[model samples]
Target: MVIADLFKKTEITVKNIELGEVETLNELTPEQLQLIEKGLQTVGFELLDDKRKQIVQKIKTIIIEIVQNQSKILQKINPSVYIAESIGRDYKYLTTLFSEVEGTTIEQFFIHQKIEKVKELLVYDEYTLSQIADMMYYSSVQHLSMQFKKITGLTPSHFKELKANKRISINQL
Candidate 1:
């Protein structure tokens, strides 16, 4: 939204500019571009000017969706398929770019995100491990517990007893 606001102050009008998040604007003076860059920096945002970086951000956005929402899309399609379709690229290319930029596979990132969600849900205490596992599409509670411990170095049950979160923000992950 801030990106949109930044563009509004200049001649640039973005119909669709997902790549690099601002890769190809209509037109803007050098002064306008400088002003927009400075504004973004002041607000703790930066223009992602590289296509590879843009892809990485897109992948992160999709994974965050999986972690935060039990959406119909997630249930209806496989993650690789969903991501590939969403971004109009082959999954292999996306995976390679993600690993090169992030130094971790997409699956690992998804697991980390899923574990973080598990921690949040555990703190809420509204659902049992079984329920959380089911909602998250884990084949079984054991599978979810194994992944949770592998990522966080603690079992879900132990994590619950602590009444604290070891999860990081989605952006950090």
Candidate 2:
């Protein structure tokens, strides 16, 4: 992986890579971190050393993974618990820091990602609205519809009918 290569190139011992994060065996010096950051920036990656930014990015990554990859089992796990476990931090701390850095609450960011996922499903036309509701962990089609309309400024059916669903990327959200 690019990140692993960056670490290896810098002689940083990598202990683990999980949940879209890398754990190093030892603390990196400021110079080493700057070198890695510059290297990553050149390659369209980032090294967020600011604590708040790191937490915010972690929150977004968790939400993106849930929305894009694990939509069917979303309701089984609480967002707060899932993020806390994934980021290895308290949920309140994560929430506060994320809101401060992102200018939106984690829940709002999550909803946006879910809406994007719904748009993708609609564009696919592989599932009915009811099926999408079930898969997306909505209590009912109406709830999903309402949320979808609130976020997209159009009803789900209307959006689907438009034949031009404008889905945003998780990174853009």
Across 75-153, the per-residue lDDT of candidate 2 in tens digits comes to 6778889889977999988888887787888899999988999999999989999999888888899999999999999
How do the residues 16-119 of candidate 1 rate in per-residue lDDT, one tens digit apiece? 64534664445667777788889889878886667888889999998898779965676789999999998999999999999999999999998888888999
RMSD of each: 6.3, 6.1
Each prediction's TM-score versus the true structure: 0.83, 0.81
TM-score, cand. 1 vs. native: 0.83
Provide the clash count, candidate 2: 0
Overlapping backbone residue pairs in candidate 1 total 0
Quality of model 2 by C-alpha lDDT: 0.85
Q: Which ten residues in a row are the worst by lDDT in model 1?
A: 17-26
How accurate locally, in lDDT, is each candidate? 0.84, 0.85
